[model samples]
Target: MTTDPLSATFAALADPTRRAMLARLAEGEATVNELAEPFSISLQAISRHVKVLEQAGLITRSRDAQRRPCTLRLAPLDDAVDWLEEHRQVLEGRLDRLEVHLRTIQQKNQEHDQ
Candidate 1:
C-alpha cells in the first residue's frame, strides 16, 4: 500500500513503544541496548522499532564506534505540528463565526421580547 509522509509518520507514532523510544531520544542519542533497557522486549525487537522510526524520518542512527546511537529528528514532527496548527486555526475561525451568529440571534430575540 502507498502512503504519504504524514500518514507514514502517524503510523510510526501509533505504537507506544516507538513513541517512548522517541521520548528517550529527545533527551539525547541512545544505542539500541540503551533504548531497550526500560522495556521487557528483546534487543532485536527494539531494533525493529528503531527501524520504523528511522524509516518515518523521526530518528536517525549514527555510528559511534561499534554502537549506533539513535537521535530524534524534529523536522517531521515540526511538519506534523504545522499541519495540526493550520487545522486548529480553521476550527477556531468556525467557532468564532458561530459565536457571533448566536449572539446576533440572542440580540434579535431580546429586541422582539421588548
Candidate 2:
C-alpha cells in the first residue's frame, strides 16, 4: 500500500544507515561507493539505502558521466520539522494549563490548612 509523504519519510529515516547517508549527502553529492566507504556494509547495501532515501524524496540521484551521484533534498526534512514544531507547541500549551491548575489547587490547599 502507498503511504503519506511524512510516513514514508519517517520510515526511511528510521534506519540509521539511511540517516547517515542523508547526512553525507548534506555535505555534498556522493556516489554509492563513496557513501559505503565509512561503513562495513557492501556497496549493494549502501545502494539500497540510497534507493530508500530517493523513494522518500529525501534525496535525488543524477547521472554525471558514468557516476550516479545522490544529492540531499531538504523539503522532506523541512516537512518533518514543521510537523514536530506544531505538535511541540500544542504539548507546551497543554503543560502550561496543567501547571496553572496544579498551582491553583496547591494554593487552595494551603488556604484550607491555614
Candidate 3:
C-alpha cells in the first residue's frame, strides 16, 4: 500500500544510517561510494539507503558521467519540521492550561488550610 508523504519521510528518517546519509548530503552531493566510506556496510547497502531517501523526496540523485551523486532536497525536511512545530505548539498550549489549573487548585487548598 502507498503511504502518505509525511509517513514516508518519517519512515526513511527512522534509520540512523539514512539519517547520517542525509546529514552528509547536507554538506554537499556525494556518490554512493563516498557515502559508504565512513560506514562498514557495502556500497550496495548505501545505495539502498540512498534509494529510500530519493523515494521519500528527501534527496535527488543525478548522473554525472559514471557517477551518480545524491543531493539533499529540503522540501520534505521542511514539511516534517512544520508538522513537528505545529504539534509542539499544541502540546505547549495544553501544558500551559494544565499549569494554570494546578496553581489555582494549590491556591484553593492553601486558603482552605488557613
Model 1, position 57, has a per-residue lDDT of 94
TM agreement with the true structure for every prediction: 0.83, 0.93, 0.94
lDDT values, one for every candidate = 0.92, 0.92, 0.94
Number of the top candidate by TM-score? 3
lDDT, residue 47, candidate 1: 86
Tens digits of lDDT, candidate 1, 1-114: 777888878889999999999999999999888999999998889889998899899999889789888899999999888998999999999999999999999999999999
Rank by lDDT (best first): 3, 2, 1
Task: Give one digit per residue, the lDDT tens place, for model 3 in 1-114.
Answer: 898999999999999999999999999999888899999988888888888998999999899999888899999999999999999999999999999999999999999999
Clashing pairs in 3: none
Cα-lDDT of candidate 2: 0.92
Q: What does candidate 2's lDDT look like per residue over 1-114, in tens digits?
A: 898999989999999999888888889999989899999988888778888898999999899999988899999999999999999999999999999999999999999999
Model 3 scores a C-alpha lDDT of: 0.94
Error of 1 at 105 (Å): 2.7
